[model samples]
Target chain A: MNAPRVIDVRGLRYRYPDGTLALDGVDFHLCAGECVALFGANGSGKTTFALHLNGLLVGEGSVRVCGVPLAASVSAGDLALVRSKVGLVFQDSDDQLFLPTVLEDVAFGPANLGLTPEEAAARAKVALEQTGMAGALHRAPYHLSSGEKRRVALAGVLAMQPEVLVLDEPTTALDPPGQRDLIALLRTLPQAKLLVTHDTSFAAALATRAVFFERGRVAGEGGLPEIVNRFHWSR
Target chain B: MRSAARETWIVERWSRGSSPLHSLDARAKLAALAVYLLAIASTSAWTQAAVAGYAVILSAALAASRLPVPALLARAALILPFSATFALITWLSGDATRALALVEKSFLSGLAVLVVIAATPLTDLARALEAFRVPRSLVLVIQFLYRYLFVVADQAHRMRMAAACRQGIRRNARPRFHAAAGAVGVLFARSWERADGIYRAMAARGFHGTFPALAPTRFRTVDGVFLCGFALAALAVRLML
Candidate 1:
């Protein structure tokens, strides 16, 4: 039996205030426990489409996460529920880890979900331990190395217990060993993941399939090697 | 940028220490600071002895904090340029006594604030402010400003380096001034985009308005005792001396 769809989007279109059409009729979906890589150029709207999954960007499209459709007028409760279900690890860890300490930053998401302090801390501890960052719990975010910051940022999202993990350029600042460790870590996670990246090798290491985006649309979709070859995505 | 990072690290390290002052509740420390400031501000310029008493009290608190006295004093002296300007104005108005008092009070106030901040982590201090009914929005602004100050400074440093490399050792003031103006504009735009990115991240994590604390602060009997004792001591110096 096939897994249920965790994320479903169709005909998504978005335009910036300056009249730039970033996402034009994009279609995408992710099945439960499947890892999919989004291959595209810099301005191909992968990030913008990823943003739509969590209701961060409301565009002209239908986005449903874990069976809940994103309403045209997003209520606070609906937005919170969708956000808790789709955790987005942004490109820059500095932008994601805004709290003072590692533990606090990780627990921020859970606490926002209305958990008690002790409960949120427990969740955060589990997430940090899973990300191999339990030792840096009390350290400040700025004091951390780039790899550690990335792990803590991942932990922050994981603490929310999202069903779908959307990582935008996760390998932006990681060294070779850091990337290897990240691949190992991400492979262990069972959540459906959507990786928006240009790193073909990194994508092949974990992603089972891939989609190619071009000019705000889905240009192609197939096996990782097939999509990479078709788009010349490798650097 | 490196100096700013070093200074911030030093203060953060001091806050994490196991000194008695560091162990005290941030609320108690903030209350004591408020009392001390009020004492200093209410003192008459002619009451030079009271001003000295305030200094002595602040010195005792600084000693209790277990931080480096000389370093903190030097840091507090950074306020002198601004205070000295006002002091000069007062002196020119034929109020030398008031002028001296102004400088002394400002220095003492700055030192007292530094002592408290050096002993308490900013997170705990922000929690203390929330507990005291400070507006959540204002507290969040202060916390975000402090957290991102280094990031912004580092960006500015990188921009300067890039501009220097492109300029190739050009030392002309006119060109340098134009480059600086352009850099400022770019920095502002980058900061604005960064702030937007931060908001999106926050929204993705379910942040509504107020930041929830991982560990809620508890006001203990010891904290109460420290607040009362410090406030009484400050009041005594202000009134009796």
Candidate 2:
């Protein structure tokens, strides 16, 4: 018997409003409890691909998040379910943490999941504790350091208790210590993860599998070394 | 940009103070404000003795709250120019008493609101409104707008700095004006994109068009008493004067 796939995609394609093809035909899969690094150059459809997982973009293809199919016209009933199953942390933490206080922002996801305020705050508390951000609960996002903001952003999604976590450029604005802290944090999460990033070293440290994207398609995917060498991704 | 952020930060800090007024339930504070405004609007005497009642009420509230008196007055004064404009029109038309009443009422109303706002955090205020049966949609808009206002201001500041860096200090005035115009258009585009991103982030977290409180509000006996006492006092002043 094989481990069931947490995410399965086939022939995924997407185009922007101006008719620019952001993603071409692509196939991807992630098994239960695996961390996969998605590496690609700028504007190579990495973020676009992540957006599709939560039904944010709804491109041409079949995509299943925890076995829930995301259709061309995603129904409202399914959207909430799909989104609940997949927690997406965007590249910009500012985009994710928009509420006035860190605690409010962290509780946002759980509150949306229909948890009462106390329950949501409790969940946020646990998530913040896990991220080592319990002390900064009342601080605003703008007042936080870049690394702290990133952790808070992750805690916001984690509070929702999703089975699959998708992070786009999780280490964009972090220093060395911050990246190290993030890797340590990611190591402890049990959910399957899809990390979209350009940092090869960061990916090499934690990813179980690595995939390289080029020109809106997956150029190669294998062990981190194999994909990195094949694509000559190192600068 | 720094000043804009600092101003908001200062108010938020003030809102967190442990004053008797701050400790009262937001609903009570709002009710008191309503009664106070009603009294001010209904008063026809326009005499210093009549309006002195309002000054006394406000002075007591301000003293009990332990907030900065000068700062509150400064913020309240922001309403003066607009009210003064209307007052000027009335004065020109020879209704000096009505004009004076307008100016006095406006100033008092502004001061009353500033006191309540200073004592209550914006999040609490929104929650109180929700409990008071204000539409959830309107409250949610207020919540997001308050949260994003600083982000938008920061973005605009960065864009301005970027444009300035390229234009340089040696550039002529005309070219700088054109650069600023172009920068404003770019800011609009970025703001629109940022809004879309924020909406997507909200959706990705199981948002279903309604925001629930993290903790429910409780209206206590003290809050009720404060509401009744304040309202009665305002009525007394209105009727006697």
**Candidate of highest TM-score:** 1
Backbone clash pairs for candidate 1 read none
lDDT of 1 at B217: 74
Q: Model 2's DockQ? A: 0.69
Residues forming the 10-long window of minimal summed lDDT in candidate 2 chain A: A1-10
DockQ of candidate 1, scored on C-alphas against the true complex (2 decimals): 0.75
Top-scoring candidate (DockQ): 1
Consecutive 10-residue window with the lowest summed lDDT within model 1 chain A: A226-235
Candidate 2: residue A218 Cα off by (Å)? 0.9
Each candidate: RMSD: 2.6, 3.0
Where does model 2 exceed 4 Å of error?
Answer: A1-3, A73-79, A138-142, B1-4, B80-104, B168-177, B213-216
Per-residue C-alpha lDDT of model 2 across residues A1-235, encoded as one tens digit per residue: 1778989999999999999999999899988888899999999999899999999888888998888899987788888888888989998888888887899899988888778788899999999999999999887687798899999999999998888999998899899999999999999999999889888898888886998889899999899888888888887
